[model samples]
Target: MSTRITGTSHLKSENVNVWFGERHVLKDVNITFPANQVTALIGPSGCGKSTFLRTLNRMHELIPGAGFAGKILLDGTDIYDPQMDPVNVRLNIGMVFQKPNPFPTMSIKDNVLSGLRLSGRKTDDASGLLESSLRRASIWNEVKDRLGDAALSLSGGQQQRLCIARALAMNPEVLLMDEPCSALDPGSTRRIEETIVELSESMTIVIVTHNMQQAQRVADETAFFLAEDGNPGGVVEFGNTEDVFNRPVDGRTNDYVNGHFG
Candidate 1:
């Protein structure tokens, strides 16, 4: 398969705050995701990292009573504009969840092409798209011979890559991953990390992970979120990964990175 790079776009969150009905989950979160780079959101559990990520593609609104304030811009256009369709926002910024979730009954090829079919996109070169997407996800060689096999036949790591392939097939400009390797074994985690690094060369990626080491390995920039004293979550530090890890301005950030506390 030829090396095909997906187009990328900058994503920015400007004064973003999120709430679930009366309870605030995220507060004044501001971050910028550079095109063709990987930005990792790192923090402890329930720090609203996932919540902030969902807002990027408008997935937060899927929950009843969940809403947010402020701008989520994709390449200078606000995704939450009244005229902007959430479906289209999602199409441009695809998401992969914490677990590997391939369609159990669908063939591997069908799983990869599912996003396009759901979006009603018509393309004469679907097979070509499938090959390229799988290759981009670094799973083409493993599953190419078994394209017609059930997606569940693959191992856990392969299943996750297949899910990524499905997202890539949509030609999304940005990819959001929420603890994508949390459920996989160490070897699988390493493979997923490799895929993340490779994909970052051509797609804007924002990943939420509790694994500090993983963030250090795959992210170019890192944003550290924190929730304290029963208050809402917010970013305490944001900078290049090395700076954030080695020279954090905030004591909280330094504590978290050095395994002092989360």
Candidate 2:
């Protein structure tokens, strides 16, 4: 199976500030994610990179006391608008978490089709969609023969790809990954990185990664965030990946990316 390029869109953030019950986690942030490209958010552990990633599709608000002020726009439309349902936003922006989390009880085939079922979408060609999605995730060849097997039966890397396949089944315009390769081994990480690069040709992608090298390898653009002196997290620098890594304008960005400090 070859890569399937589908939904694509430009995502932008404007004056975005987030608070978790009065504790500000993210200060005013503004960034733009070009269509069919991968943007990486790189920072130290408590810098709120993952928090900002969740805000792209309104997932940040799922936290009990979380609140944010600002606009997250998809194709110029504010996704946080009261009239814009979060479910719809999520449908267009799929997410994969830090760990591989396939539904243990569901078969590999069912796992790929789970999104369609959850979204209440009906399609006559479920089998085709499953195959294409798995292929797009770069895992179809590995699991083609065991579609009826339980999802947990696959290896860790395969499970992660399966999750990506499931997300692709929704035909999301953007894909948000939060340290999707953090728990994987070197080989698995490389495969996931390859999948990310391949997927970017068809969808907008934003990833939160602590590894500067990984960011340099997979990201087209990079944003550096920091939370210093007890201040809230915010982007310190942003630019093309190569420039951000090799010729950062901000001293802090240089320090972080060069292993001097984080």
Candidate 3:
């Protein structure tokens, strides 16, 4: 099986499949996440959008019985290789989840620095890194004078932005976000959307959302997944965002975009 896609590709999965014990969760998924751009994955509930995101950074293995076969490539390197460290893969491809899960015990500054410590990196450069990361997340000035405060003390939006800042402090080449806007208010959601668009100029982004309007707002490319038989998931359609939403090649895609199905 082909393991990598070269020529400016930031990430890819070739014939990837996932199973949880006897039940398959994902089937034969192949796609490329481009460098310095945002690729949105959208589908109805239980369609494996989040599973695909976890696979990108190798988080599917967090489940005890979960298993998968296929190569996940980051910058043309095989992330699933037997000799590769999953931790290293995750370090380079950071992730932000739907919930704002900053460490309750950590100071905001410490929250941003924690990943570096876990990855065994020095913290000397953190001041500048933290400043830049929080700035990129659009939360710098709001929390600048209170960096030592507990991350959990922030409002829901601030906590989420802090999580984004934590991810950014890693200097990741790609960022995977799973329904990041789901729990946020419109104003905060808009700021995060703007951040995604801006960060796309420097880092490859893969976001999974059920929100069609969100997909249209920021995605340069979009992939639609379908859960056939209410079981295993598969890619039903994929193409440029404009075409996927406006001139889909598949009837199911057209129906989904037109709000005919989940």
Ranking by lDDT: 1, 2, 3
lDDT of 1 by residue, 1-262 (tens): 2222224487999999999999999999999888999999999888999999999999999999997899998878898989787888888899999999999979999999998778777789988999999999999999989999999999998999999999999988899999999999999899889999999988899999999999999999999999998899999999999999999999999999999987
Off by over 4 Å in 2: 1-8
Q: Once model 2 is optimally superposed onto the true structure by TM-score, how far is the C-alpha of residue 107 displaced, in angstroms?
A: 0.8
Query: Model 3, poorest ten-residue lDDT window?
Result: 1-10
* Model 3 spans with C-alpha error above 4 angstroms: 1-9
lDDT of 2 by residue, 157-199 (tens): 8999999999999989999999999989999999999999999
Q: Cα lDDT for residue 185, model 1?
A: 96
Candidate 1 lDDT score at position 66:
97
lDDT of 3 by residue, 70-108 (tens): 989877788888977788778788999999899998999
**Model 3 C-alpha lDDT versus the unseen true structure:** 0.89
Model 2 vs. true fold: TM: 0.96
Q: Which ten residues in a row have the lowest lDDT in candidate 1?
A: 1-10
Cα deviation in Å at residue 123, candidate 3? 3.7
Lowest summed-lDDT stretch of 10 residues in model 2? 1-10
